[model samples]
Each structure stands twice: as C-alpha cells, then as structure tokens.
Target: MNAIPGARPPDPKDLVRVRDRLTFLFVERCTVNRESNAISIADGHGIAHVPAAALSVLLLGPGVRITHSAVSVLSESGSTIVWVGENGVRYYAHGSPPSRSSRLLEAQARAVSDPSLRLAVARSMYLMRFSGEDVSKLSLQQLRGREGARIRRLYRQHSQRTGVPWDGREYDPDNFEGGSLVNQALSAANSAVYGVIHAVIVALGCSPGLGFVHNGNYRSFVYDIADLYKADLTIPIAFDIAAGPLTEAVGSAARKKVRDSVREFRLLERCVADIKGLLSIAGPVDIDDEELIVDDLRLWDDREGTVAAGVSYEESAEL
Candidate 1:
C-alpha cells in the first residue's frame, strides 16, 4: 500500500449518522481492498465498490482476505466489522469502535449494576416479545416460564403452518448434523438473525456482554435482543425451509432466507427503534444535533458530580 496524492482522513462531522446508515452487509469468499474512501470487493464474479462510510456493520465471513488500507478507511468511517462463520454465526469481530457517544453504554452499565433496574429492563424486554400480555407483576422465573410456553406455542404453530414435523428443540453446537432437519433449520435461522442483531448492538454502542435477562456469556445481550424477533421472523422461516425438499446445502438456504427477510421487513430499522425504546431513550440514537456529536470528556466525581478529563488534578488529590 502506498499513499495517494489526494488522500485525506474523513471528516467526522460529515460522516453519515449511524441511524441513517445501511444495516449489516455480509460478504464472504472475497478480496477486500481500498479504492479511495470506498471498499472494493473482488471475488470469482468480479469487483464492486461499496462506500464504507454508509455501512453500519460489515460482516466478513469465511474465505475473505482484507487489506490494511481497507481496515483504516472502514475504521475512520465508524463501521463495525465482524468475523463470522457460515450463516453469520459470529466467531470474532473488531474495528471502527463505537467512539461517538457513551450515552447508551453508560446507561446499560448502570441498569445492569442495580438489581432492581436489571429486573425492570428484563421485564421490559419480555413485554416487547409479547405486547398482548402484561408481565410487569411477574418475577424473573415466572417470566421465563411464560416465555418458554410462548415459544413452544410458536414452534407448534409454525410446524403446522409449514407442514414440518413437530418435535422438541434439540441441537448440539459442536455437532450441527446431529439435529433433525427442522432443528438444523432453526439453528441456521437463529444464527443469521443473531448476527444482524449483534451488528445493531455494536452500532448503538451497547455492550453485548451486559445483558438484562440472559447473562454469563460474552454475547448475552445479543441472545436477549434476538429473542424478541424469533417468534415472528426466524421461526416461521425456519419451519418453511424444513418443509421444503431436503438439500445438502440447508445452511446456505437458511442464510439466504434470513438475509431476504431482514431486508424485506426492514428489521434493522425496527430493531434499532425497539432497542432504544427498551433502553428508555427518547428518540432515534443518531440525532443530527451538534451537541450530541461534540466531545465532552469528563471524570466522575461523586461529591462534585464531574471534573474535566485532561486537566491535572494532583493538587486536588493531595488536598
């Protein structure tokens, strides 16, 4: 890689707002290179130019070779890059850290740290999955029972609708082939949906590890959020795929369906709105207000509320 005559860093103020940007873009088996600001994807088919600044998330699946220049441009644009397995099952992700604002992350940390707030956030998420019922009075264990029943009903309903066999959900992560056809389909569909939801989480500056309901794993929040849409989006699609004639490429089919469904239902936009609502944010996360984008670094001071980050405080510390 060599420096170009007119190359320059992207202006932060001029970059597209996160909410306005396109959702996750999945690419596999391609060569990624930089052509000025846009990323060039070259594969067996050909090369295509994609504006890195316009994408919120870039999913790099298996068989992809990316360049340093490509990484630099994408990072400057604030796009989140993820490395994943087939059907968007995440393996690793890095790049273009969400440095714009700490509002959502701080709020999430506070909420999770407090037991009461954590319960309330969990209740809010459960309600999102089934708006018809009021589980505000229920405990976490009760909520889990109700959710389990609801998901079971959904599985039965989709199985009937798609004429797929009704069997219990069972799958081993290490051995994908051990599961039945429907189970395999469900796994593939869920993975695809999770990938997209994970992208949204990163774009909004939320920690995938700090979950309100589901916890323990690094992607606890990702699983928590993806649960909201499973009954509506992925489950039915999975059943339908299972109903179709068997294919050796069931995983590929599932991925394709999930991608099309996401685009068709505008799941990214709705996903963004749902997350903001759950987090108690008043409006779209990416607003055009100058004050929101400007750097306002500060230090936490319990007694005085805050102090400037950059200034030396050795005298105050001694006093």
Candidate 2:
C-alpha cells in the first residue's frame, strides 16, 4: 500500500476489482499501447482506451498485436491475457501471474498431489455440479461416467424443450462446420466458458495444470471449473440459439448469447466462489485489497527487500 505526499490513496471502491468488471473483454485486430498509465487499443482508423487493470480477462483474438511494455503493464496490474483464434476456438498462448502467493499454490499442490485428497476434491467438484447427490463412494471412473450421462440427459432435455434436434455431442476443432448446427453452437459456447474459467484460475494463483478429473492439458483446471456450469448455462443457451432463426454467423451468435447468459446469471462471481469452495481455500483472494508491501511479499531471493519509496498506505480511516 503506497501513499504519496499529495497523491491520495486509492479508495477500496476505486480499486480495480476483477469481480466488478466485465467477465472478460474480447478484442481483435488491434495494436495495444500504453499512453501514460492508460492502456489503449488502436485499429488504424481510431483509438480507444481500456481499463486493463479493471478487467478480469482480456481475450486477444485474431490479428491482435501488443507491445512488450503493454504486456508488462497489464501483467503488473493483474490482468490475465489470452491469445485465441476466432470464437476462442484455438488457444495460441496466454500470460498471467505465474505465482501470486506460495501459500495457495502449496495448498493446491498438496491436495492435488495426494491420491486420497485428490479423489476427495474431485468428488467435491462433482458434488458441486450435481448438488445433493452423494459421491462419497463413487470412484473417479464412475464419477466420469455419471457426469457424461448427466450431460447427455441435459442435452436431450434442452433439445426437447427448445424443439431442437437432439444429437450426441460431437465436435471437430479442425473442421468445426462438419458437425451439426447444435454441435457448432455448443463448441462456440463452451470456448467462451473456458476463457472465463481460465481467467479466474489465473487470478486465484492456482496452477491450471493440476486438475483432479481432467489431466494432461495446460488448462485442465479451467476445464474442471468450466464443466461445472456448462450444463446449466452453455448447453441450454446453445440449444436455444440453434433452435431459433439464424440471422448471423452461427459461431458468432452462439458466443454472443453465451456471454449474455453468463452475465445475466452472474457466473463470474459464482466461478470465484466455486473455485474457493472446491479448493477449500479460506479467506478472500482479492490481490488489490492486500497491502502491497514489497518486503512483506519477499520478491527477491538474494537481496534484502525494502518498501517502495514514497509509498505507504493505511488499511482503514476515520470518516
């Protein structure tokens, strides 16, 4: 927490809290720059400034270009950057806080690394999705099978309700159009869901690579968290969109609808709480709320750390 002589400290309300911002911002074909401390995006014709720090996730879509300085500033401000293809189908790369706090990471690693604890967490995650079902004795394989069945049933129920043809889940990332309209819509919807989950995972300072049910991919944890909401949010939305008359590109409409549904349902806040509950992580993880004392953070290994000059802050004050 840094307090300048004349420069007033940031009010907790004015702080760039991720939960208050849009779930995620998707930008395409723009050059990112830092004008003073403000982040701006330009696409030749015009320029627009964006509050990058206030954003939870910044999805850099096709033709996006960013400078090293811009990246550094955004990273320092605690925004997660993800580079993806059209409709967020192909994830090219991403950058976020590698490790926010050793405590959370250690806790996550210990739970995920241990066999018994890992399975317990997996069951807990499943229970969160199922809500009321007891998965205490369900093995990982049994849990997976049950999950698949439940999702299939959801697809059927939604299909019947919306009057869309019910087809099994099928998607080919390479040939997206090869599948049915429903499948295409599902793909687009799920991609947007993954983007949000990825941002939250990074912001919480947990390793995305460590997943209980899902494994191998870099975004296993993202998949795990995103799956919890898909049946309720994405799946139904996809069917509704696919059922209605199409006025635009299928993928575009699907993504737009999915985003709208996410916002309406307040899924961003839900995602944060769900992750905290699943990981058994206590307390809040709001980085901006913490007093940013350099010595307290222990940034350097060899050198003695000192507080940033001309910067001190108080936690609470008189009205």
Candidate 3:
C-alpha cells in the first residue's frame, strides 16, 4: 500500500498486530518522508505513503534513502529496519526493537549468562528442530554433530524431492551470480529468512549478539533463530527455485518465492511465537508488552524534532 502525503501516523495500538499485518517489505530507490507523523516514500515517479508501524520488517536495500523524520516515525511505529545488499545477500546493520521494557531482554541475558540454563535452552531448541529427539544430556560438540547430520539429511531429502543436484553449500558473496545455481539460490533464500527472523529477534527486545548454538557475530542470535526454520522452509524453496529454468534473475526469483512462502506459512507470527517460547524462562506470560513509552519520543522531539540523535527511539524508551 502506498502512503499518501499528510496521512496520520499509525496508532500505537497497531503495534500489537504489526507482525500479523505486514510480514516483509523490500524497498529500494525511494525517499522516505514524515507526513502528519506517518511515512511517505517517494521517487522521481510518485509518492507512496507507507504505514511504518504495521510492518514486521522494512528492508532498505540498495538505493534506498531514508530521511531522519521518516526514521523517527518508523521507530515510533515499532518496525524493524534492515540495511542490506540486493536481494538481502549481505546483512550489514539493523535498527533496534520496538519495546520499551527491558524485562524480556534481561531474561534473555540472564538465561544466556548461566552455563546450565544456556545449555538447556540450546538443547530445547535442538529438540524442537529434530522433532523432540532427546539431546538433554548431549555436549555442545555432540549437539553440533547431530545438527550437522540433520542438515545434511535435509539437503539430500530436498535434492531428491526436487531433483535439484546438491553439491554442498558453496557461494562467494563477491561472485554470487557466478556460483552454482542451487548454491546461489540457497544464499538468496537463507538471507531472506535471516532478515525476517532478525526483525522478530530485535522487535522482542532480545540481543542478536547473545546466541545459544551460534556466537561471535552481531547476528549470532539471528542465525540461531533462522536455523530453526531453514530445513523446513528455506531449503525446499531454494531447491525449487534452482530447479526452475535458469535465468538471469534467479536471485530475485528465489527472494520473491521465499517471501511468498513465508507469508503462506504465516512464518512471521511463528517466528515471534518461537522467540517467546524459547526465551520464556518463567511461566507463560505476555513476553512482548504493547505498552509504549512516549516520553522518550518527546525527548527526541525536544532535541531534534525526532528521537535522540544517536540513540534509537526504542533504546531511549527502554526502562
């Protein structure tokens, strides 16, 4: 949906349903503007007003230019903004999550800090992935082995089902188009999954750096969460895209297919629910509270007519 000029900012109440309403929006070559507290994106052709609050993730790919006011409106709306290369091949940076409370984030930090609890969470993730296989007592190394085996098996299964030849995971970022068809498709497909899961991870106020199965990078948690759905969702889609007639637009095709399939599966909602379930150390409660702290935004307004200069609205709003 295109945003018209002078549209009212989305109601803060809409934050609760943003995940279910907008899954992912890939934008490029557009200038984002703040109109009547909402976002309006324009190019040389026309102006399209967008509801920044209702999006799960807004992918700012190549050529996208966002204004400061637009950034303020987006953050206030609680949507995750991702800066990435074309077709999301290379993830570079991301905006903070939408929540004001640090309750869930603090819980995540505590669980990941404790050795026993960290291992338990990792094992629980494995059980969920491998269909309840008992890995309660497995060492991290052994768990990695089992995970690798499962991944290999999935590659084989998908290859057989789709008749797409598998020659191991291989791709060069600088030379993506020159790689094998399936390998390129895999990269394209997995990047899309990572983008969506990263949004949910940050939106829930969790740290993307603190991961259970994966570590060391800013996207460790993103990788960990995306891995949960790769075997089932991305793997098959990549294979299917690769199996189609070779074309110059394989990467874009794979991306579009992954996005469509994700929507069909309601994967955005699933990602949010899974993050909550995995991180919930206590009995089930509302892991993500919809209550927003507007005081921070007011501070931003006083400083620069937006959020704090360096700090994101979410960070300023956090208690």
Candidate 4:
C-alpha cells in the first residue's frame, strides 16, 4: 500500500492470520495481532482478520473476515478502508499510529496569534478560493481587491507568486475540461484538510463555527483553524502538486492524487506541529484541577457577531 503521510513507518511488529469474520468492534477496543501483525477486529462474539497491507478497512456489520488475497489487493491498489456503522467512522493506518499528544491544539493557537503564521493561513485560504489548490504567493497585501474582498485579495497574492490563474468564479464540480488535474486534486486535498481541522477542533472541545478569521454564521472556528494551515503548509504543497506530475481528472485517480499530495505535503505532521506552536503562544488559563490556556480568538456560532470564549491554550493542549 502507498504509505500514509505521518503514519509510523513499517516495522517488524508481528504477523498473524485470522480465520473468521468479526464485526461490531469499537475503535478503542481494536488491536493488531502480535503474531501475524494484522489487525484483528472483533465484536463481542465474532472476530475477523484484516491483512497488514490494507490501507484502510471499514467493518460494516457483525461478522467480516478479510481474506489474505483481499488484503493483498488493497495493499497493491493503495486503497484506504473505511468502516461505517451506527457508532462512528474509523480509519486504520496500514502501519502504526503516530504518537499521541495535545500538541496540534497548541500549534493551532500559536498560528492564530503569530502574524507570520496567520498570514500563511490567509494566503493558503485565498489560493484555495480560486484554483482550489494550496500554492503560496507573495503576501495577503499584494492581492487586488473585489467582492468577497478578503478572499479575492488572498487569491490574487497567491496567483502572483505561483503563476496560476485566479478564477474568481465559484467551483464547478461539473466542469473538468479546462482546469488542470492538479487543481482538482488540490481542491479535494483542501476539503480533506478542512474536515480534519474541524474534527480536531471539535475533539479539543471547541466549536467549529467560531473563528478569528473568515467569520461566518456557522462553524467559524473550523474555518479559522483551516485558515492557519494554508500559509504554513497547505498552499505551498497544493501548488507544488498542481504544478507537478498529477493531472485533474476526478475518480480513483484524483483520489489517489489527493492522497499522494497529502503525503508529499506532509500535511498531517505539519498540522500537528502548527497546533502545538499556536497553543504555546496563547499561554495558559486556570481550570479546576488543571490549568487551561484560553486563546482570545473568535469562533463562528449560529448567531452573527457572537464570539465564545475558548478554552485556555494549555487546556486545549491537554485535550
């Protein structure tokens, strides 16, 4: 399987085989087999073995045993498995999970506070608005102004630096003839990044709508966090990929391009670092037993112009 960026590099963990189908397993309860080193998923009564090479696996029912050949196919095809159930979704890294920490929250906080980082995010967001890719440009100030002025400014700046055209029109999911494949892939990558950012923000106990920049009546904070990623990482990488070998036809190829670009961008690792850095700058706030560092950032709530006080930076770091 193609390697997932930020996933632990493969190692000699173990190798084992499963003979039965298992289902209804919660993510927290799942474990990898020590002997075959494959993932052994189980509900209370049934069990199944997923080959080690599978990029992603989703358990849809009570009993599902993935055969050795299936695993091989997934590995060779570089496909990710997704589990869909009443509970929630789970993505299994083909190898190992990265070390856990509250660092990403902290970095997010820092990115918002720091001018350079914040500008980076703004630039990235702007680029996304036009080409739907992450390619860095000169600066936010250099871009020309128009309706959705903030967005236009950012995109113009990005275009200036990357030499990619700034198409002010809304994204046309139906039209793929004119746009480059890299542009299409970058857009998909941006969507994925946005999803992850929102998930991380929610995981930290912050509302996604409330944000410092890109304010809206809905989940603004999600946009805020997404904004930070643009400059520091996403924009440059998006542009790099768009300008690279990948083309814009959607489907399996587009999906693969997005995955490959994400890995090549090292977005996951950079995001983790950015979150940690941002939080460290926000400082600490006192909670009951522990200290929570709340950053003075605005988030998007359902109400217009409403800002909720966030958890302390240190507190979010602990999440």
Local distance difference test values of all predictions, in order: 0.78, 0.75, 0.77, 0.42
TM-scores, each model vs. reference: 0.87, 0.80, 0.81, 0.38
Identify the runs in model 2 with alpha carbons over 4 angstroms from their true place: 1-14, 44-47, 134-137, 281-319
At residue 24, give the lDDT of candidate 4.
Answer: 15
lDDT winner between candidates 2 and 3: 3
- Pick the lDDT winner: 1
Q: Give the count of colliding residue pairs in each prediction.
A: 0, 2, 3, 54
TM-score of 3: 0.81
Clashing pairs in 2: 1-292, 3-312
Best by TM-score: 1
**Ranking of all candidate structures by their lDDT, best first:** 1, 3, 2, 4
TM-score of 4: 0.38
lDDT tens per residue, model 4, 154-190: 5667667777665653334456334564455445445
Q: List the candidate 4 regions with Cα displacement exceeding 4 Å.
A: 1-166, 172-183, 231-248, 251-254, 279-282, 285-319
Error of 3 at 6 (Å): 13
lDDT of 2 by residue, 62-128 (tens): 8888997777667766778888897677888789552345555556787888888788778888877
Could you tell me the TM-score of candidate 1?
0.87
Question: Candidate 1 — which residues are off by over 4 angstroms?
Answer: 1-7, 245-248, 281-294, 313-318
Model 2 scores worst on lDDT over the 10 consecutive residues at 287-296
